[model samples]
Target: MKYLSLIIMILMSPSCSISKKNASVVKEKLIVTFSKGKCLGNCPVYDLYIYNNGRVVYNGIDNVKKKGVYETLIALDTVKRIEYLMKHFSPEEIGNTNGRDIPFTILKINDKKVVYRSTRSSGNLLKINNLIENIKDKL
Candidate 1:
């Protein structure tokens, strides 16, 4: 019975082996970051919105007053995938959750892999289309 349980665990482990041919067909999550622009009277922490194929999936804004508030907005096809990631990955601290531009970190990917933008990608914001194009072949 111990051996049987071990076998089940091994088989249930996450897999990240999507063939190049099928990578495009798989539903992958999209994580995008927006800049928390400079302040005038009160710094506006830009809102975070996750849109999949032009449809909104999750929308949350940060309400912090500090400048340079980084926020991550994640868009996945299913809530189960998001929950799985939230359980596995540790997220960054969000200065504000009610205003706009709440930064986020990748918690986990269901397939054990994800395609996201690098933090040092030129400007503060990373293009979603560019990220998708960069990881489409890898899935």
Candidate 2:
């Protein structure tokens, strides 16, 4: 009986409590990502990842004010708004291009991916650009 009590106490100790690390490890899946490609001129090249848990990560490579890696936790409302925008726009409709000189924008949602390499950006691409800017502002 004493040995059983000791084992139960050990199991219920704070040290054996749910680990924060383990909880964080179960992160929300990737919701959307926007990647800016290099241009002939000094255009900011970076990748932005928006996770379902309202976690945003920006990795800036060159010609940008915010360089290096940046992480921000956005509000749940913002996360929902982004998800709505992505669903409404529908990435599958955007066609892929191979414009090397002009800057390109890559928008991805789960398995569906779209790359916009047009110099004259419009329609859904413009909305995506606006969405990225809105996210950046929030961050």
Candidate 3:
């Protein structure tokens, strides 16, 4: 009976799945991915990703000042602000809102997402996009 109890206690203890050496290799969860499509004129076309580790990855496709893939890092707090913005002011937009001359973008988080073609977004959603823009400038 004592042996059984000891074994149970050992198994229930916090299992150290991430060791110290391997800790650095474990990346935070992917929080968001934004993809922008081109328009009739010079509009930036790219894809951006944000991870909880404050890592940002940007892939500029065409018609943008920056071209090619670039990776940059930001503060964890900024990433958290992004999380808050996403939760508090998620856009209800479901379809393309602007004409063909304007660009469209898809912003995804977890299982939910919103797509819009409007030149701008509403509320804190615009802040989220602004944050992404700042991330890209760092790259």
Candidate 4:
């Protein structure tokens, strides 16, 4: 009886909200940020922030087609992708040593931050980055 009561209490606690089966129903505020630093070569220098509320903010600093702040909304598919990443992908995968580069890329999802200096990136991370670049390019 005591073990059962303890298990019930744990499930009822606030900390269990995220890993629960109903996480999608109780979705938290999601914020994904991507920033790239300058390199000896002219690499794109900018910061991009994506929020679960469908708002996308991009700040183009230097070496890009555009140099300004831009904001827009993202598609529902993008939001779902981000939520999946935040829920499953480990920190090591984000900082995975695929290749090296002169510039550094910083990607932050909620509290986790991955800073990598790589010339190439693959997977959903790459797709999200491309989305940021496209948005900045049009502005």
> For every model shown, what is its TM-score relative to the native structure?
0.22, 0.72, 0.75, 0.62
**lDDT tens digits, residue span 1-139, model 2:** 9999999998887663367766676777888888988989998798899888888899888988888889988887777765666667644445556556778788787776777764455665566677676776565
19 Cα displacement, candidate 1 (Å): 15
lDDT tens digits by residue: candidate 1, 1-139? 9999999998887566645546755553443322233333443334332333322222223444322323333344433343343344422311223423322333222333322223323221133323432222122
Those runs of model 3 whose alpha carbons end farther than 4 Å from true positions after fitting are 1-26, 90-96
Alpha-carbon RMSD, candidate 3:
5.7
Rank order (by lDDT, best first): 3, 2, 4, 1
Q: After superposition, how far is residue 2 of candidate 4 from its true place, in Å?
A: 59
RMSD of 2: 3.7
| lDDT of the candidates, in the order given | 0.35, 0.75, 0.79, 0.71
Stretches > 4 Å off in candidate 1: 1-26, 54-139
Whose TM-score is greatest here? Answer: 3
Candidate 4 lDDT at 27 equals 67
| Residue ranges of candidate 2 with Cα displaced over 4 Å | 1-20, 90-100, 137-139
lDDT tens digits, residues 1-139, model 3? Answer: 9999999999887657746546766656788999988888888899999888888888999987888888888899998898888888844533338575877778888776878764557677777777877787778
Clashes of each: 12, 0, 0, 0
What shift in Å separates residue 132 of candidate 4 from its native position after superposition? Answer: 4.2
* Maximum-lDDT candidate: 3
2 or 4, greater by lDDT:
2
Native-to-model Cα distance after best TM-score fit, residue 137 in candidate 3, in Å: 2.0
